[model samples]
Target: MKTRQALFLVWAACTALANHGAWAQNNPVLLADVKAPRVLMVEEATGTVLLSRKPDEPFAPGSIAKMMTVETVLDALSRSEISLDTTYPVTEFAWRTGGAPSRTTTMFAALRSNITVRDLLSGVIVQNANDGCIVLAEGLAGSEPAFVTRMNERANTLGLSGSRFGNSTGLPPAESSMTAIDMVRLARHMRTAYPQVLPLYTQADFEWNRIRQRNKNPLLGTIAGVDGFAAGFAEGAGFSLMATAMRGDTRLYLAMSGLASEKERQDEAARLLEWGFNGFTSLTVYGAGNVVGQAVVYGGAAEKVALAPREDVRVYAPTGDLGRLSAQVVYRGPIRAPINRDQEVGRIRIMIGDAVLQEAPVYTSEAVGEGGLASRAKDAVWSLLFSWL
Candidate 1:
C-alpha cells in the first residue's frame, strides 16, 4: 500500500508539471503591461504579513467571493449543524444560475435531481460551479440571501473585520468585497481548520459525463507545493486568487487581486511564497506551565508559591530578532486565601521592543490557606508590641 501511495504521489507531481508547462505557455502575455494591482503574502502559523501591497484595501474580489461560501460551508460542517452525506433536491433556478465554464460543476440543485451535500461542496470548491453554489446555499439556508447573511456573520466571528459578502458563488456583479489581509485570514481558516476539505482546491479535473471540466486555478500546477485555493476573473474584478503552498515547516499564503492574466498571478504568487519561506523563522518562546519564577504567596506555610504558566506560547519572527524580546509576569497578589491549580491568577506579558506579542496566563501553583484564629491573634499581638521595631 505504501509503495502504491508513493507511486500515486509521483504520478500526480509529474502530471502537474506537464500541465503546468502547458499552462505557462497558454498564460496571457499582457500582464507585464499593467502596474500589477496588489499582492499580499502571509504566513499562517504566524500572523506575519511577509509581503503587503495595499493589504488592507478592499478589492472587487470577483469569484474570490466564493471564499465566503467555502468558509461558511466548512464552518457549518465543523459545527455539526449539517451532514456531508445528506442529499438535496436540485431546483431549476439553480440550473439557470450562471458561473465558470465547467460541466463537472453541479450544486445538485435541479428540479427532480438529487445530490449529496459532499457533491455540492466538491463542485463549488473544485469546479467553482455557479449553479451548484446557489443550490447548496438555498438548500442549506433555505435561500441564497439567507446563506450570505450567515457568511457575513461568520466573517465577523472570524475577526475578518474588513470583508463583506453579497453572494455565495461570487460570480458578481454582486456587492462582494474583500481585502488581501482579510482573504489571507480566510485562507488560514481553511488551511488549519478544515484540512480534509482542502483537496477540493487541488482537484485538476472533474467529470459529470461528456462534459469533463478542469479547475482554472493556475497556482496548483505552477508553484511547487501549491495546493488548495480558488481563482476567479470577471470584467470588473479582473483576475484574482487566494493561493497557498507548503515547504518544510514553513507555509505561504498569497492573495492577489486585479491582475492582468492567470500566468502573472501564478508568478507573483511564487515570488511572494519564495521570499517568505526564505526570509523567516518561527521559535517556541516557552512551554505550557513553565515555572518562570516562584511567586510570592502570603498567609500560607511557604512565603512564596510555585509560579507556572497556564499555557504554551510561541513566537514567529525573523531570525536574529528573538533575543530582543523579554517577558514580565504581572499579578495583584499577596493573594488572599484560596487558590486553584491552573488558574488565570496572573499574566506574563511578552514584549519585543515596544510591541506586546502575547500575554499568557500564570497560575497560582499552590493554594494559599487562611490564617487560623490563634495564629491570627499571635500575629496581631506581635504587630502591636513591636510595631515601631
Candidate 2:
C-alpha cells in the first residue's frame, strides 16, 4: 500500500505537489502556542481563517472600545455632521468620568475647554483617552447613550452581531462585550470603509494640556508589518488587542483578548502574525478561463465538454510541502446537451487535507449541441463501451 503519496498537480505548467503526510510530521511553527484566552487571525485578501481560538466567545473589550468610538466619529465626518476642525466643549460629566481628576487614563483635556475633532481623535485613538471618547460621543450624538445607540447600529450594519456597546470608551460598565471574531470584522470594515483613519493608530503619541501620552497598541513598532490598531485591558478582561498589518496586498487582522499581561499579549500577537506570514504561501491552483478538467456529455454532439474555472483559484496554505494540497472536479455527472459556453456546470474544489481552501466554478468553454438520432445511437454505444473505463 502506498501510504505516503506525492501527487504531482499541474496548473499552467507549474508543478505543485500534495504531500499526504506533511501535516503529520513535526513542525515547530505549528507547535508555537499562544497564551491567550481568545485569539483569531484572518487573512483579509482570501478571508481565510489562519488561526482561531474561541473567536466567537464574548469577552470584555476594556479600552479597545475606542476603536468603535473612532469609527463612529469617522462615520459622522463622512456624513458632513462634523469636520476635523470642529470643536466641542468638554462637559462636566465627560471630565469627571474619563477626564483629568478621575484617575483613569485620560488625554488630559482641560475642564470646560473646547477641542477640535482631530485633537480629540488623537486623544481617543493615540492616547486611549477615555474622556476624549466621551467628549466625542457627546459632540456627535448629544449624549453617550445616544452615541452608543449609533455604535450598536454600526456594529449590526457591519455584521458584528456578537458585539454590544454600552459606552463609547471600552470601559467596564460590565455590559460592553465583543468577541474576537466580531472585533476582526469591525477592524476589517473600518479599514475598508475609512482607510484614512488607520494612520492615526500608528501615531506614536499625542500631546494635550502640556501632557504627552503615547499610543498603547503594543504591536506597533515591535512588529514589522503591524501599522495601526488598538489594545485594551481591564480588571476582568486582562489584556486585549485588535491589530492589523499589511505586507503587499495581503492584509492580516488579529484580535486577541484576555492575556495575563501586556507583554504576553504583544508576544502572542507577534508569534501568531509571524506564523501566519512565514508559515503560509499563496498558491494559485487554477487560472481564470483555463480548462481544469472535462465532463462527460450524455446527449450532446460531442462526447465530452471542457470545464474551466470561472475565476482564479488562489489559496493560502503551509509554506512547505506544497504536495499537501489536492484539487478535484466535483459536480453531478452526465451533463445534458445544448450547453452554452461559459455556462457553469461544475466546480473545482481545492483542499488542503480535509479543509477546503477554495471552490472555483467550472464553466463550459464552448457550446455543445444536441446529437442527431444516428449520432446519438453511436454515442450511446460508445458511452456504454467506455463508461467502465
Taking all chains together, each candidate's TM-score versus the true structure is: 0.67, 0.84
Q: What is the lDDT of residue 286 in candidate 2?
A: 70
Which segments of candidate 1 are over 4 A away from where they belong? 1-58, 74-92, 99-116, 153-161, 179-182, 191-193, 233-239, 256-264, 293-306, 328-341, 349-351, 356-359, 368-389
Give the number of the best model, judged by lDDT. Answer: 2
TM-score of candidate 1 to 2 decimals:
0.67
- Residue pairs in collision within model 1: 90-109, 90-110, 91-109, 91-110, 107-132
lDDT of 2 by residue, 68-156 (tens): 88888898899998899999989999999999788888998888999999999988888889899999999989999999999999888
**Each candidate structure's count of clashing pairs:** 5, 6
Position 322, candidate 1: lDDT: 50
Please provide, for model 1 over 140-257, each residue's C-alpha lDDT reduced to its tens digit, 9 standing for 90 to 100: 8998999999999999999888788888876655788888888888888777798888888888876542356677576777778888687877676578888888888777787888
